[model samples]
Target: MSRDEQLRRAAYEEMEKHKDVVEKDPYRLHYHLMPTVGLLNDPNGFIQFKGTYHVYYQWMPFKTGHGAKFWGHYSSNDFVNWTHEEIALTPSEWYEKNGCYSGSAIEHDGKIYAYYTGNVKDEEGNRETYQCLAISEESLHFDKRGPVVHLPDGFTAHFRDPKVWEQDGAFFMVVGAQTRELKGAVALFRSDDLENWDYQGVLTGGGEGRLADFGYMFECPDLFPLGERDILIFSPQGIEASGMKYQNVYQAGYVAGQFDSATGTFEHGEFEELDRGFDFYAPQTTLDDKGRRILFAWMSVPDQNEQDHPTIEHKWLHTMTLPRELKLVDGKVRQVPLEEMEDLRVGPAIQVNVELNRETRVLKAVKGKAFEMEITDLSMTEGWFDLTVGDGIRFVYSSGEQTVTLERKSYVNGVVEKRQCSVKQLNSLRVFVDTSSIEVFVNEGEETFTARFYPSPNNDTVRFETSHQAVFTIRKWDLKHVNLK
Candidate 1:
């Protein structure tokens, strides 16, 4: 066997050893693609081909940790059930010696094309990136087309993660890149035959007047049309903490704007973060047949020094969040859980109107760690309102004079970690509570909080008692059994 085949075989063998723990129980994913084992990062090549949704991911098969990259495949008919496929692109080719990084997939005529980045390290430990392409005529067998577009002209080896889409009868691609001066930007390209690409100028960059600083570099840049405007999604590195922003080691988000293909520049407004939870990054979207824009994101930050994660002992480290429908609501993208999740609701349900701050406190059967609750503020109230849902888990939504602070308690041992931004409009709040997670969408995405929790099963009662009195409407739903096999 060839040396590349040896490496591919070694990686596959490692995945086999940790298969049990890696493919364990999946939680809270409504209708989206997820990993079966090990670590799943960037959402590579998402396409709907031959009446099936094919979603591939940046996979590391060696260990539960992020190792050499592999393109892991999955297919779904209704976005509900997924069938895992064999490894699509193995690192058994010289063009992709190190690994096959993140990219997008497309279907043309009858063939499915997978475009990705070939990442390699030279003898001197220098990184090399080749924009690679491959073809799968039958969706199972692949023929590597080798590197189609090499390092264009001015960028360094930091160039990677190509996202391709067809618009207005032509194909356009955007890739995350960095200048030789170490500035972060996205390079644009136009391709006709998927093999030949014409280089366009820098689409946009992160600088002083820019939305974000031109940090070390950007990765997994994705551009798509949303409503009347355009949305640019990417992961920016080296953003320092400035008060209430950039809390993670690396940030993945989007900029609302309009992309001008004529000048290759995107006139963008302030950057809006996609998620406020502990882990989310490298999101990619695909347009479905129904004309709805659906998106999926890696639920963990990249290159994090995760050592003692409980799941790591079992051999998997990450998962993807539920598939959310993306809509541009008032200049910001509003992500709502898909309607298909409603099918998971079984048994009798209950709704309540809780008068906050009263000793009326806990609602009877209205308690669960895994359920949905929508709270609408009838009047603007002051002080803090605590919604305790069994055990020590708390949903602290404080309308502190100016803004609302949404925090999750008893997560990871009483951390009381705060995700999502505060809602200034203290009029109402819509929340969804699951057995082990909480998702708060304030005023339809003006602000949102998605969190994971671990509370005992017996402690499933939800209590609502505020520090001050505030009239409210709470609607609850008892979810059906989730078959996470």
Candidate 2:
């Protein structure tokens, strides 16, 4: 067999070896996308081509750690039912011998083109980076075209993750980079055709403009226009904790700006974090046929508590968050769960409107391993409100402090950890509870908290408590598992 075929066979064998063990894990997500075996991270090649949605991710099939990644593929016509496609790309060639890192996909002239980073390391441990391309005429089998863009000047080999878009009959690409002086940056490039690319100057970061000396490195840079303003989203490493922001090990945030495509200049605003919870990084967005910007992010952070995840015991790790629709609301990006997600709702919703003052209630019908809960028309007369799901996962909103907090038991040690964000008022909340995860959307997505919790499978109780007189309506529906085959 050829090298590519040999590598593919090895990956298939690895999956077959661990498939039963991974499936038996109680922490496996019921509705989220996870690797069949080994590890999965970074949603790449997310696009809608020929009326079908395709999502490709970074996968390492042989082990539950980062290594030479294969492009795992999945497709859906209605966005609710997903069909696992064949493996899209494998790191068997000379350019991507080490790994095929993250990138994006674009459709041009009836063909789909994917751009990704070719991560290479020599025997001496020196690194070489290349921006590679793979074309798919039918959105299934990909033809690797090798590296189209090499490492540019003044940047280290930490450069990768090319996000490409078409503007005025020309293609523009944004790449995450680190300067030779070790400053995070986003470099721009232009391509007349898909093969040859010309380097433009740095668009932001690297002490070039207002955002000077932000972080040590930037990864998975995505640039797109939402409404009248352009939004640039990237994950930055080496940013220290600042008050309630940058609390995670690495941060994924965005800047609202205007990009002058002719001059390759970006004038932007301050960086704002996309998600306020743990386990959200490497977010990738795609514009569908209906003119909606939908996003899916890796539900686990790098170098945080990866080793402690209970799923690692079952030979698999990490998953993708639920699809979210992005809208520019009031000068900020608001993320709401996709409307198609409602298709997963099974049976009638259990509805309740209650007034509580220094009371706690546990409705028997509002408990499940996987469900969707929405709290609306909330009005509190005084103190705080708390909602505890499963074992130790708690959501609290303090009126006096004007803050929302999510507390969960740490997977590494049993210590309770909390992540908080400031909110002026708590008007509404939409929470999605899966087998091993919780995604909380506060006040119509002004702020979001995405997390993974490993509570006992039998403990599915959801409790509500209030310190003051608070009136709110709660509606919950059990969600059915999406067909993943």
Candidate 3:
């Protein structure tokens, strides 16, 4: 076998040896994409080819830390069910001896061309990043074409994660970079063919003009047009927590406004976090065949208490968030689970339109590892109300404060932790609960908080209580598993 084939074989062997142990973890999400053995990070190379949707992610098969990463592949005919595919790219090439870092993919002339950053570290521990490509006809086998775009001047070697897209007959790439001054920036590149590339200029961010001194480095910069406006989605490092936002070690948000293709310039509004959650980072989107922009994000944060996750003890860690459909409402991005989730519904769900007073109400059919809940007509939820899921997670909303908070016991310690977001109203709340994670879409995706929490296994009871008189309707579902094999 070739070196890449040998390396891929070894990684798969390692994962198979520990698959049973990892699968036994109670925190293993029932419906989400998770690492079979080691660690999973940024969702990369999300593209709908032919009729199948493929999602690749940064994965290390040996351990939970950020070791040398391979592009782990998963494919889905529909958005709900997925099948794990062969390891797409291995880090055996000299250009990517250290790791095959994050990038994008495109299908041209029936050939799927994968563009990614080949990460290398010299003996002195210095970093050398190469924007490389690998082409495949079957999408499973790849022939490496090294370094289409090399390191440019004016930036640090931290330049990586090339998100490429085709626009107006030419391919454009946006590389997340850190300037020599250590400010975050996105470098724009243009190419007629997939191999040769021409460097444009910085699109935005950095200590340039109005955005003087943004984050230290921006990772996974994706630029795409949304309706009348353009959206620039990226994960920026070194942003401090402001109130209830940016609490994670890093933040993945978007700047939606206008972009000039000729000049490679973008005039964007303020950056907004895509998901207000305990764990969300490095989100990527791809337009489906039906022209819907679908997203999948790493449901775990990096560096911030990575070892705290109890799943690592079982020889695996991390997952991809539920595939969400993206919508632009009032110039802001709105994300909700794809409607195909309804197809996963199995048993009869609870439907109740009742008034909730100060007492707690425990709905018998409103709880499961895989389920959906719709809560609406909350115009009179005057004070704090708690929607408790089992023993751990609690969705608390204070209409008096116009804020929603998700509080749960920390995985490492039992200490209570919270992630809060401000909302103007509490007209509705749609929740999707999968084994260990919960995604809350408030007021039709106006605000959201996604999180991973470890409730006691088999304790599937959902309870809700109000501090005062609150009238709401609740529709709940018992969902079936989307088998990932």
Best-first order by TM-score: 2, 3, 1
**Candidate with better lDDT, 1 vs 3:** 3
Expressed as tens digits, the lDDT of each residue in 367-404 for candidate 1 is: 75556666775553677676766664565656675444
Q: Count clashing residue pairs per candidate.
A: 10, 0, 1
Q: How many clashes (backbone atoms < 3 Å, residues ≥3 apart in a chain or on different chains) does model 1 have? A: 10
TM-score of each: 0.88, 0.99, 0.98
Candidate 1 backbone collisions, by pair: 45-104, 45-105, 206-214, 367-462, 369-434, 369-435, 370-434, 370-435, 371-433, 377-428
Superior candidate under TM-score, 2 versus 3:
2
Q: So what's the TM-score on candidate 3? A: 0.98
Question: Which 10-residue window in model 2 sums to the lowest lDDT?
Answer: 207-216
Q: What is the C-alpha lDDT profile of model 3 across 331-409, one tens digit per residue?
A: 9999988877777777776888867878899877677877889998765746878799878799988978988899999
Q: How well does candidate 3 score on lDDT at residue 287?
A: 92
Supply candidate 3's per-residue lDDT for 440. Answer: 92
lDDT of 1 at 171: 79
lDDT of 2: 0.92
Best-fitting candidate, scored by TM-score:
2
Which segments of model 2 are wrong by more than 4 Å? Answer: none
Candidate 2 structure quality by residue, lDDT tens digits, 18-54 = 8889888988888889898999999999999999999
Tell me which residue pairs clash in candidate 2. Answer: none
